[model samples]
Target: MGLKSSQIKQLERLYRRKIAPKSVISSQLVKDLCTAAFELGRIVGLLVNRRGSVENVILGDATRLYLPDIGRIRASSQRLRGLRLIVAKPKKKQRLKAKSNMVFRPSLYEIDHDFIVDLEKLRLDLVLQIQAHVEAESKKASLAIIADKGTKVEYFRDVNNISFDFSQFIAELEAKITSQIKKAHKIALIKGERGAAILIGVYLKTQKAWKYSLNELKELCVAAKVTVVDTEVQRRLKLDAKTVVGQGKLEDICLSALHKGAQTIIFDCDLSPSQLNSITDLTDLKVLDRTMLILDIFAKRAVSRAGKLQVELAQLKYSLPRLAKKQTGLSRLTGGIGGQGPGETKLEVDRRRAKDKVAKIEGEIETLKRQRRLRSSKRHEKKIPTIAIVGYTNAGKSTLLNALTNSKVLAKNELFATLDPTARRLRFPKEHEVILTDTVGFIRDLPKGLINAFRATLEELKDADLLLHVVDATDQQYVKHSKIVEDLLGDLKLLEQKRVIALNKCDLVDSEIAHKKAKMLGGTCISAKSRSGFKDLMAMCSQALWPKDIFR
Candidate 1:
């Protein structure tokens, strides 16, 4: 088993070529700056929609319940509106010589050619054997590498180029090279509200957050420091795998990720564990599907007792089924906090124990739910017209809730800052008291685990008389945010309830921009930090929920 010089092998090399080489190009500063900018864009792509390809399965016209790259697509468009996402598909055609087979016999001089004829059969057999070998060799395989922990573990890698070893390079990088080709994500087809596709890494500048109307969503990313690659409303695409805007677009995402040295990818749509694993297996990067990102946000934003428990519950539930197909690295729960517990290893170690723990958590969550139910009953008895602040995560709902009531809710500039519901009674202009409840911030992709765990808390919104749908007016993809909230609300049957879109974070955008966005979204613009337009917003809510008799 030796390599011959005739074979050509591509090795992964760290190209240190100066961005603008002094020999041919000019200033190194420009080169360095441009290189830095390029790197920043690449990193943003990796952070935002790390999964280069997206394939969504729309369960209903209102919301995308299933995405191969993401688990769920919460099109939070209040009343849904007329958002049409067209996904173009290539026309299929049938081939003429479809099941053709051939039988060949060598022709030669009768007697003299007998030996040559036999030789031809030998050649044919050898060709068949070689074809089988090549096919077998092309399949994916695993590689063992020694990590910094001094632990030797086998990581799955593509099997390409393994059969013909290039002793010139180490096996690991070679494995990565093959793996990238086979599985490396190139085009991250992320969808915004309305099934709009956003390919961040390939086209959009990753360094910048989603701006314009997307400010609200952008702020969430900035607050969470989560990268935003791209957001789109795709109309047509493949249903089977769901990766790529299409095959060609997928190729582009893979190429883009490869060019920028991105080892991770994301999709706006939430993906199932199997979908996630399959994508990761193809892209060779840590695929952070939409649900994973939302979970990450929840993990980062969770603060209270119930919040932590709910987050843990959701994480465990979302994580369990995906357990069947996890990366080897995902199994190790050697660390703390996020990956501290049994983790991917738990699936390998003792699945029954993990299952038992999930059940125990469910039981505990039920107890919590009962407590929330008791609280809801109290509110019901009071007959108070409760106003629940609900909208896309990081839409300044927390900040506004804090400003209005001075309740000091954790209004950090982060996504999903308030996972648990917090309520406070506030006096209106007429001395009428109403309970303002801040529930979990909604996102385009909310994991089922989280929804299930936080049901007790979310039930607040269901019973509420009015919903304060906060929108970050400054974010570029605000429309997308609005849609996510709408879809989730619809899923909860809250859209039929009275609601007002409180466009928060108006300070980030100019008056002109704010005015237009407000008009388009049918939401009033205000900044919680500046305490601007609070009066009008309050009046709007009071007017919507309060009766003329109460005011009189």
Candidate 2:
């Protein structure tokens, strides 16, 4: 970063030099560039527009070149940035001396993979790198451009001999890229409206559950209508304080996302506000963490006014900390005359508005809670036993409810398909009826804010005369899934409530295996889709809810 005044002036002069647009660079200019970098013993970079005018000059350490922010151009767009990068790095003599004994002579240098990533991520027209050496014969150069598959790289043995019509080459390259993009677009049209995403996971060295976490994250993305293109994982003793993934890894991910035409990056774990800001600052790709993805799904799936309010409250509370980032020009004095209040900064005003909105939503939810309580009281007066359906998300809870009550409640095979609690009357042959309520499903590491926001809805579980715990028999981690649900119930102080475990989706598993698993968990095997074992499930529920009616 340190440069003498003369060196600074030399770099400033680069902006004044113009070359013919048809040529990549004149041999004399290349010599001058190499000479400057060789003298400075650092990497030098130039951002050149298509018209052959230098826009910016960058300096980096001996090993790498750090380009400045080039503005937010969507990487997935079918266009190229009207710019190219030319970089030159000084070759060290000690390395050459160490390899002097080799029978075959080594070339000066090769292009860095990071630069190729930069080329694709920035959608640059092309990238050229020159290895500057003191001896003219040892100097070499490399050129890279976007190709049909990924990137096409070509090396020049001697920098002086490099010659190409830059304008024609770039025009042809862009044409090919446009054709490829058109083909890709037609394919995507047939695939429905789903955005592409990359999944990222950062875990401590001691953590071995990352695979399951990522698997669930992928499911969450699918539920949110996002198509996952690839995944990245890192193991660290401790996560980076700023970006959860280290800076280098974050850059690599951004580049990979660009390469795959992914529009979003989803982290498997929840991110702190500062971490989110830090990561977003490094790339323009849309960034989301697990909590945000879940909140988005809830916002989409909520069908009732109360459900919508609860989700909005949770999102507002979750984003309250993110608004702490400083905002410019919000601190202007608004009280021109006798207004007695201290003018609030824009940041303070934004936080105040968010807090007020959250309070308003919470108040509305309270009103809904009272309405529910009134209805609950009327049911209490009727002396009907309340049975609430609860289980891990996508575990056939809604399907089971529909199978039992014959009511249409938007049963889908996606996570959080039903957000609002649905109630139906289950009448028995003996004139005994129970209030069956289908509540929202739970997941592992469910956001705490969501839990607190849905308190009014979940409170119904406390009043539940019996809890119908449904388990997905096909899940390999069903035991762990059950434990997560139980732990959440324990947190809500509903663990002591009477419970009946029903292993749903038994038809999908082997009959013997399903029965064995049901026996092991002290539950009944039933297929919510096929009605198999429903009799046994109902018998167990009746025994728990009305022990005296078990003989009936």
Candidate 3:
């Protein structure tokens, strides 16, 4: 079709006002004109005066244009400034509606009026159809441009052709977007209530064992008010002596921590001083092994002065060895048997301070131990029976104590929730009364430093008339936990004492199953939350503590 008189006038105005003034037409303006013309269902060409001798033509829809005589021609729009616009006619007439539906309705209206209405409807429909076709072709071209990877590829005429793999570009863009999202998520988590930590474990055991241990570590972290974002576990026949994990695994762990925005790395097992240093140095993140994590929980949970002293003493003892190990120069100082001339380094000074702090805390603990003994002696004079509640961490010991004495203690589901020992009086039948004390919970690999430092508090156990070993019946590792507590009791030399086991958390398990487990472990099933089966537990305690008495 030919251009209308009005369209030609508009084009002349555009050229005079926007195009003719510039010596060279901008590539953007060329692209705009081409896109507009193509949308209007017209193919256009730019005829430019090149060097005033020959005319050069630049066509829209570059893929349809061919130049057989030119070898590997490159298209450029920089020199096409004083160009005349050329519009090509459509190859075929576009149909507005299906021909089968068209019919002459002579009886409906006057002939001229009906013909005009039908022709206008057809014209409107034709424009809509052309717009739809243009949109479909545009989408197809975009997809082709994105998917093309061959050595020779055609690009849009107005845009620069940059040789690159579209697939690789899209992949890299997606990765960058995903990384930004993760970083924002991590920042939100950090700026919220809790800090983030990554848990790492190296185990020679089965996956089940690793899961169990790592879960406990996670609980410990929770109790300390730290969020564990991720965990990494490696299974090997032997653990790496320096970093606990192999070098490659350590690097992976570091990268994972960085990606997760974790500020700390927690190990499942205790690390030696040298191992801790090596891992921290490599990761550049604060590293804490299982023992130190437990100590941190205790430090946060301890409320009483005595409890705080015990925790500090343990921490100082643990740090002393690390401090000594940090001073590699100390070995040089001890070169000869009689050579003692070198002065103290900063590490030595820190070690000395740590030792002094340990001594002060130990002396305070001894004084407290003495005071505890005197109190115990006074209770013994009154002939009052005493019962101690002991169990694994988070096994509901504090809940059991609260249930028995009707006193509220900090009973939480997290490990090491209650660090300070709590004591309450429980009155039995016939005015018989016994003092029940709740001690710190035990774990599988309880730190030796903790045990030694808490001796002042644990000394209360030695004078007990009977031991109430509380066991968590609902724990999947209940049996292992029971063994751990029993082993610890044996180490404390309280195994020979009169003991009664109260299978706690029976509310979480089937009654029959709990009863069976209690029987197998020689315990009485009870639920602290529901206060079920406590009468039997109390009767068993009475028999064990005051056998042959009328109260029993």
Candidate 4:
């Protein structure tokens, strides 16, 4: 996801410390930071208002915490004093009692930043006497990149104070940032107190997902049930974490989370356990990484009992290694994509209980697998040729399956529609029956851990007599998608298997044009949505899997 140890150390040599800014913070960092912030805002519509710090950003809802950038100390327009020690506001329940000892987390983004101003204790009386200023609205401040623009300088304002649209502000922010750091090639992302869940934007594709790529990653957050009050992306976003964005941007994310009432910050990229803890410490919000989101979707779509158990087992194994980070907020951790676990603290005995539970579940799955195999063997004994449909997520494999066999599988325009291997028997006109199985979708750079975990399920593909490689015709990234699937199949050691590439969504493109593409590539073309080319696809399947001698 980032610089190798030696390379990072070389960078440290230039800066003289690990926390010092490196070349990585200048190029892609701001973009990634904006993404995280947008995601945070989407999940929780909080604000990174000026109320957070003295003329700086404060992120809190029922609880308010202070934050400064994690980098070098720099002079600010705001005033500071020696006596102004940060403290949490008194709760309604605690107003009658003395305020207890509590820890207040300041900003970690500006780790190099701290104030050494001198002020008398009398100043604390004046400030703390009022408790804290209740800001009707936070200040929306503008930052000039006399320095680095990749740093999404934080400011808050009352919504009534601003006249301009937030999106325009973000576009201009990117322009100003890039213009400031024209020489720097890398970007830096500093979210939360520390940079967490950051990832490099490989191959700067202007388009994302389908051809229409989102300039704002906050869109993913909105999709994940987060809200968006405001977002600003500085140019030169840095990729510090493989999953989370940056620190400066994370403040905005926290702000958005508060605004939208989102308790969980789900990253599009996966976060390691260490990184997860680091971000949570800063934001005090549950952090769900990219893998967790995928797993969550799996958990939701798992209708079959075996499918649910398999996903649960994989999720438990994935979470167990990460239990060390989940100390104070284990009960608060709800089952998002990443939070699939027993919610039990691991005492010495708890570990044994978990291990025993895992073994017992595995034994049950083994029994279930035997039952599945018996059914497969019965089908195999009858020699009803089987075909497995496999492709990148949302490539319309389920739609194709539904169209081909008249089965009622949920055919949504979403990813991972089919988790279980759904098969229905289809009899060819020549009196030959074939079994069609719909399996999980593939993606680029699928993790080795998940691949190993889903091995039992994926092995179902290995027994197939033919592979129906479905490609989304409407996808401009089909070339890259095709390569990813090919690489996965090669890794699965099924590269030599006989397969037919079914270019689905032909209705989206002109049939003549799609068929021309198919003919040129020597593949089948069909529009599962429109049924424009389904007959040709079926004929090809029958020709590929069955002999003509029986009908003749």
Better of 2 and 4 by lDDT: 2
Candidate 1 structure quality by residue, lDDT tens digits, 1-552: 132332112100112222111111113312332232232221100001111111121211111111123211211111111111111111113244433474332221011122112112111100000001121222222222212221122222322223322222233433544444333233322322111122322223243432332443444444444444444433342433545344445544543444333444555455656565565545444566556656766777677777788788887777777666445566465545666555546456555666788888788878877887788889889887799988877678888888999888777766667776888988887667889988877765566677878886787787788988888887667897788889988887777999888778888888888988988988788989999988788778878886573332
Q: Pick the candidate with the highest lDDT.
A: 2
Q: Which 10-residue window in model 4 sums to the lowest lDDT?
A: 116-125
lDDT of 4 by residue, 388-415 (tens): 9999888899988887788898787766
- Candidate 3: worst-modelled 10 consecutive residues by lDDT: 123-132
Candidate 3 local lDDT, residue 328: 60
lDDT of 3 by residue, 392-500 (tens): 9888999999988999888988888888989899999977899999999999889999999998888789999999998888899989999999999898898888999
Whole-model lDDT per candidate: 0.52, 0.85, 0.66, 0.53
List TM-scores for all candidates, in order. Answer: 0.52, 0.89, 0.66, 0.58
Model 3: per-residue Cα lDDT at residue 62: 20
lDDT per residue as tens, model 2, 232-336: 989988989999888988987876666566778999888999998898888888899999999999998888899999999999999999874875545545554
| Candidate closer to the true structure by lDDT (higher is better), 2 or 3 | 2
TM-score of 3: 0.66
Q: Arrange candidates by lDDT, highest first: which order?
A: 2, 3, 4, 1
Lowest-sum lDDT 10-residue window in model 1 = 123-132
Collision count of model 2: 1
Model 2 TM-score, 2 decimals: 0.89
In model 4, how large is the Cα lDDT of residue 189? Answer: 20
